[model samples]
Target: MDLGTCDDSGLETGSDAFLALRIRIETHIATIGIIGLGYVGLPLAQAIVERGYPVLGLDVDTTKVETLNRGETYIRHITAETVAAMGATGRFSATVDFDRLAECDLILICVPTPLNRYREPDLSYVEETTRAIAARLRRGQLIVLESTTYPGTTAQLMAPILEAGGLRSGSDFFLAYSPEREDPGNPQYSTAAIPKVVGGEGPEALELARLFYASIVAQAIPVSSSATAEAVKLTENIFRAVNIALVNELKVIYDAMGIDVWEVIDAAKTKPFGFMPFYPGPGLGGHCIPIDPFYLTWKAREFEINTRFIELAGEVNTRMPHWVVERLALALDQRLGRGLSRARVLLLGMAYKKNVGDLRESPSLRLMEMMEGRGAHVDYHDPYIPEVMRTREHPSLAGRRSIAWNLASIAEYDAVLIATDHDGLDYEGMVGAAKLVVDTRNVCARHGVSGANVVKA
Candidate 1:
C-alpha cells in the first residue's frame, strides 16, 4: 500500500491525528456569553441568539436584568419584540452571576470604558470585568473584548489578567480584540450588518475569533495583532473628531463673513468626489466620537509622542459649547439690548444627536451649564427627555417644562438656542415665533428661515 494512503487500523493507532480531531471539536459548537448588557452587548447577544446559538448576557445592573427578563429594551434601536422573541425561544437571558461565565465556550466583554473627571482614560470597568472573568477562566474558551479603548489594551493588560488564572493564552484559552461599532438610530446598518474587525495575540486565537465572528457578522476583517484592531477603532473616531472640529471652526469663520456654513456645505457637496460632508453642530457628543480618541492620546504619552491633532481637535470641540453660548449672548444683546444675566434663555433639544434620547456626553448639557454660569436663566425643552439630569457639575433646575411650540413662549425668551435639531420639533414655527434665534445646529436654514431674525453659527 502507498505511504500516503491511511489504513483504518493505522488511523486508530495514530495519537497525533486524535489531537487534531479534538482541536476541531473545541473550535465548533461553542456557547456564547456576552458580558455587559448595554447598547453594545444586548444587541450582540440578541444577534447571536438569532443565529441559533444559546447566549447568556451578564450585567451588574439588576434593573437591566429585570428589563431583559421581561423582554423589554431600554436602548432606542433595539425593539421589545425582538427581545421577547429571544426570551421566548429560551436562547437569551441575563444575570449578575460571574461564576457561570465558565459555562460559556466563548465570552465577549462589552463593558464601558469611560473617561474620568480629568479627561483621562478610565479602565476601572474593564479591569473589574477582567478580574471577574479570571475567576472563572477555563481552557478551550475564546475571550474577546468588544470595548472601545487604546491599543495594546487587550494583549498587554487583559492577557496577563486571563493568564493569572493559570491558563495559557493561544494554547489553553483564546483571546482577541474586536471593537463594537454600534450607531444608535441608524437605519442602514444593524448589529449583524456592520463589518467587524478582529485581531488576536496569536494565530490560533485569530483563526478562532474570525471563524466565530464570521458566523454572526456579515464580514470580519483580521489585522496583524490585537493592538492594530484597537487602533482601528480609535482611528475611525479620531478622524471624525478632527473633521467635526474643522467644520465647527469653519462655522465660526463663515458666521463672521455673513455666509451660511450650511449653504456653503450644500453647494460644495454637489461634487461627487474628494468631499464627505461632516456637519457643524452645537458640539460633539455620544460615547465614541467625544471619548475614544482621548484614550489614544492618553496612551500615546507612554511613548513620549504627542498626538497634536487629536489634542487640538479635542480643544476645539470642547470650546464649542462656550462658543455657542457666546453666540447666544450676542444674539440676545443684539435683539433685547441686554446682557445674558437675568435674560430668560430657552434651549431646544437636550439630547446630543437628533432622534435619539441618549444624552451621554451631550454638548447641550454643557452649553446649558455654561449659560447658567453666565447668569442666564436657562430652561431647556426636549420632548424626548422630560427631566434634565442633575449632575455634580449642573444642579437640577426645577419648574422647567417642555415649551410647547407656541408663539408666546418663543417670544418670551430673549433668545432661543437650538442645540439639537430633532425631527419632532417644529423648526419653522419656532423661527416664525421667536424674536431672535441662535441656530447652532444650522437647522433653521433647512426650513428656509434665513434672515436677520435668525443667526447661524
Candidate 2:
C-alpha cells in the first residue's frame, strides 16, 4: 500500500514541455488516446469523453473498433446507448491505427498481460504495444500503462524500449503506470467512481499522470514509482486470490463434515468488525484473481525466493473445478444411481461471474473439459454469453451455444450443475425440474429454492 501524496502544487512550473502539457491538461484540451477497446478501455474512454476531453481510441481488433464506431457495444454493462452518446458528442472515435499515437497528448495502454503455457508471465501484449508506441513516439506525450503486471515492468521493460529512440523519459516524454480497476457488471463501482493509483518514472511524470486521472476519476492516488504502482495492482488481486482460495478449501472441508459452508459464512460475516467475507465458488475466475497472483510468484524467483503461500493458494484454487466435478459425480450416482459416464449434464452460467458476458479465464471451461474428459455429455446455459468464443486455452469449446432455458430442456438433462449464481435465473424452476442438482454456488439455498434433489457442493 505505497500510497504517495497527491499534492501537485509547484510542479506546474517546470520546463517548457511540462508547462505546455500542464496547460493542455488544465484546459481539458489534451487528446487522450486509449489502446485496447475491450472491458477496461471502452468505459475509460467514455469517462474521459464525458469530462470534455477529446478521446482517440486505439485497438488492434477491427471488430471492436467497427462496433464502437457504429455506436454499438460488445460488452453487456456498457450499453449501445452509451457508445451512441459518445459518438454524438463528437469527441470520441475508435480506430485500429498505431500511427495515430502521435496525435494523442496522453496515451493509456490497456492491453492484456496473460500467462504463458508454463504459467509464467507473458508480456507479449505489453511489449508489442510499447514497440508500436515507440515507433511513433514524439515530444509532449504522456504515456501511461494501465495493464496489470509485476513490479518493475514499466521501468525495466517499457521505459528502455520507449527510450530506445533517443528520448529521455522525464524530459523528452513522460512515462507512468496506472493500473486499471474495472469491475464489469458491478453497478456500485463504475470507471469514474473508483480511485486510480498512479506511479511515475519521475516527479513530473507522476504529477502529470495524477492530474490527468484526477480529472476523470473520483481520486488519483500517487505512489513512489512505477514499480510500486504495478505492485499495488498485483497486491490487490493477490489478496483476493488468497482469500478466495481459503474459502474454496473451507467449502470442501465443510462439505465432508456435513456442514453448510455458505451458512457458516453467513453467520461469520454478521460480526461488525474483524471479518470481511469472501465467498467460495467452483473456482476463481475473471482476468485477475486466478492469474494475477502468479505474476508475483514468477517475479519472486528472480530474488531466489519462492512464493510458497501464494503458490499454495493458486494450487487450491486451480483444483476447485476438479473438486466440483467429483461432487457432481457423487451426487449423480447417489440421487440418480448413475455415474457421469453417458450422463447428460446441464451447466448453468458460462461467464466468469454473474450478469457479465466476459469469459476471460472462466473456471467453467475447466469444469466442462473435466466432465467431458470423464465421458459425460455437457451443455451450457448463459444469458450473457450466447456462444463460446475462441479462447487461447479452450479453442475446441468455441462456437458452443448455450442451451435454451426452460423446464423441458433442464428436465432432459440427467443432472444440473450451478457454477455461477447469476441474478434473475429461474432457480426454483431448476430445482423442481432437474432430477439431480449439484450447487457449487449455493445459489439454490440463497434463493430459498432447495429440494431433496439439490446437493450443495
Candidate 3:
C-alpha cells in the first residue's frame, strides 16, 4: 500500500553491463517503465512505486495521461488518491510520449491484445508498443511484455521488433514475457499479491526478469520459455471458459429436469475433492474469460490442432442469453399466463461482474437485445453503471441510460431479470413489485426467494 517513489537510474548500465544493472536493481536504483496505463499497467505502476522504484508510465491515450498528470485516476479500483500520492513524489508520471523509453532500465508492456471483429488475435497495440520501444531501443535494458496474447508473441512478434534496432536480444539487451494476472474488483488480491509467471528469451534474461518481479510481487515463477508463460495464461482462462460453459450447459439440462443448478452446485461442492464450482450465469462475461481463451484457439490452428472444447464453450456461452430469454417467456406463461411478447422486462445489472462497471462481453447487453427480439420491452437498472457508453463490442446500446429504481418504477416492468448479482440492491422490493421475476445468476435464491413468484434460468 505504501508505494514509495524514487526516480533516476544509477551509474551506467553500460559499465560492466549485467553486473551493474543487477546491482542497481538490487539497490533500487533501476527505473521501471510501463506502457499502456489501463487496468493492468496502472495498478502495476502503483505496486512498483510502493516497492520504491521510480516509474515512467506511457500510454497513447491523452485523457489518461492528463488525468494522471492532474493527480487522478480513471479506473474504478485504482483511486485518485493513489495516483495523486504517486505523482506528488515527482517520480511517477504517465504520458503519451514514447520517447522516454530510453530513460528506463526496465520497461514492461501491458497493452491490450483484444480480438478483432472476426475474433482473431488483434496484436495491434502490442505491435505498436513494441515498435515504439524499438525506435528508442538501447543496450543494457530489459524489455518484458506483460500483454496477454497468443503463445510465441514475445519471441515471434516483439523480439524481432526490438532486435530490429541492431541490438541483439540476449547479448546486448534482455527480453522476457510475463503474463498479466489482474482481477479487477477482487479485494482479496492485488498486483503485489498475485504470483507472476515470467519466462525470458535466455537464462540471464530469465534471472533478471524473475528478480524484478520478485522485488515487487509475492512470488515470481520462472517457466521454460516465453511461449510456455503465454500458454500458462491462455490455459488458466480456457479452463475457466470451458468449465463455465459446462456449468451453463448443465444449467439448461437441470432446468428441464426441474432441478436448480445452483442447489446442485451447492450439494456437489460438499464433496470438496474433485469439484470446483463455476456458477452458471446469463453468460460468460469479463475481459479475460470471454476473450483470452480465443488467443489459444487462434494459435492452435497454426499447429493443426483443433480446439473443439474452446469452440464448444464459446458456443454454449453465447447461446445462454437466448436460452435465458426463453426461460423468461416460459416463466411468464407459467405464472401470469402472459407471453414475453409486449411484456415489460427490467434487467438488474449491466456489468460483467458484481460491483464493477466494466461491461466488456457482459451477457446483460446480449440478454437485453435478445429479450427485445422476443418482443419484450427491456430497460436496465445497474447501480454500478448509470450511463451507457458506446463500446466497440456493443455500439447498438448507445444513448440508453439507467432507469431510476423505485417500487412504483419496479412495478411497471412485467418481469425482472437478474443478470449480475451485485450486492446492496433492493431485490426484496423488486420481487414484491414485479409480477414475474427471472433470476439468471441465482441471486434470488441467495436472497431467500422461491415458490411460483420467481423463476431460475
Candidate 4:
C-alpha cells in the first residue's frame, strides 16, 4: 500500500505501470473497488469475489456500508445468504471512506445517473464521484464507469477532471466505460451471465477493461469509444420505452372498440419473425425505462435534432396513470352505483415491478397520488414491499405500511385496483371479496378468475 517506491511490492510508476497493473489483473491479485454499494455494485462485487479477487466497496451511505459489513442486504432479490457468503470469503468489505479508494488497483463507478425535476439528465452524482476519484488519482490504477449516461460523458466530462491531477489518461492511468445491465430478481441472468459492452479512451485502457471484465462475466465486447458504449445502453432502454408506448396506445384504442389488447398481442406474437410482444401496463417504472431514454433526448437537443418518436412515447406512457384512474371511476359508477370521490380503494403492489422491492420511478406512487387527489381513501398491499420508504418524488407518502392480506381486508375496500401483478396473490378470493375489481394488468383473467364484477382498464 506504500506510494513511494517503483517496485511491484509497492506502487508502479513511469512506463511500466500499465504492465504491472495488467499482470496484477491477469493473476487475479488486484483489489477492485466499487463506488456504489446498491443494487448494481453489490452484485458486481460478488461476481468479482467469486473469481478469486478481493473487493473493496466504497459508498457515501453509511447504512449500506454497515449493512453489507454485517452480512445483511437491503435489496429483496439479493438474499442475506448471498451477502453472508461474500463476507465469508474474506475478500469483500464496504466502507463510507473515500480515502481508501487509493488502496485499490481498479475503481468502478456504479452510482446513479438520475433525471432532474425538468426530466433532464442530472450528472451530479457522476461528476461528484469523478472529482473524488481525480483527487486520489494514481498511476497503475484503472477507473471504469458502469453508470448509464449520454454519449461522450466518459471522455468529455470525466477525462479532463482526472487529467487535472497531472496524470495522463490511457497512459498514466486507465479509463473505460461499461454500462451496467443488472436486472433485479431475474433468475435467468445473473451479474456474471450478462455480457459486457466495454469501451475505453485508448487501446491500452480498452485492453485492460476487456481483460478485467472477461475474467468475471460470460463475454466482454470491446467497442471503439466510450461514447459508443454509452449509446449502446441508451439504445437498449429506449427501444423498450418506445415499444411499451406503442402497446399502451394500442390498449387505449382497443378498449374503446371492446377488444382485449392482451388477447390481440398473444395472437400477433404467433407471427414468429416480425412481431415481438410488449405488454401494456398501468405505467412505466424502474430505473432504466422511465429515465434513461430521456438522457438521450436531452443530449439530442444539443445537436439540434429532435427525438420526436422518443418524446411521444414518453407522453403516452406518462398519461397511463390518469387513464387508469378514469377507468376506475367509470367502473365504480356503472357497477357499484357510487363515485370515486370518497370511495375506499385498495391498490395492489407498491413496487415498480413484480417480485422485487425496487420502487424507483414506480407508476404506483403516481397512481396513489392521483386517486387520493380525487378524494379516494387509498391503501396498498405488496408482499415484497412491507412499508413505503421515503422517495424524492413522493415524500408525503412516506411511513405508509402495506395492509394485511386476507378476505376481510380485501372486502373492506369499495374497489381493488391491480397496479402491479405480483404472482401467488389469491386472485379468485380477491374477486369474490371485493365489490369491484379494476385490473390494469389483466391479472384476474390471466388467473382465470373473472366475473361481471371484474373490469379491465
Compute the lDDT of residue 212 as modeled in candidate 4. 97
RMSD of each: 4.4, 3.3, 5.1, 3.9
Candidate 1 vs 2: which has more lDDT: 2
How far in Å is the alpha carbon of 305 misplaced in model 1? Answer: 0.9
Clashing pairs in 3: 3-50
Q: Clashes per prediction?
A: 0, 0, 1, 0
TM-score of each: 0.91, 0.98, 0.94, 0.96
Candidate 1, position 58, lDDT = 91
**Candidate 3 regions with alpha-carbon error over 4 angstroms:** 1-15
Model 4's alpha-carbon lDDT is 0.93
**Candidate 1: stretches off by over 4 Å:** 1-29, 390-408, 450-452
Q: Write the per-residue lDDT of candidate 1 for residues 352-423, one digit (tens) a residue.
A: 888876777888878877888889887788876676655433455433456666667778888788898888
- Which residue pairs in candidate 2 have backbone atoms (N, alpha carbon, C) closer than 3 angstroms, thus clashing? none
**What is the alpha-carbon RMSD of candidate 1 to the true structure?**
4.4
For candidate 4, the TM-score is 0.96
Q: Which candidate ranks first by TM-score, i.e. highest? A: 2
TM-score of 3: 0.94
**Which candidate model has the greater TM-score, 2 or 4?**
2
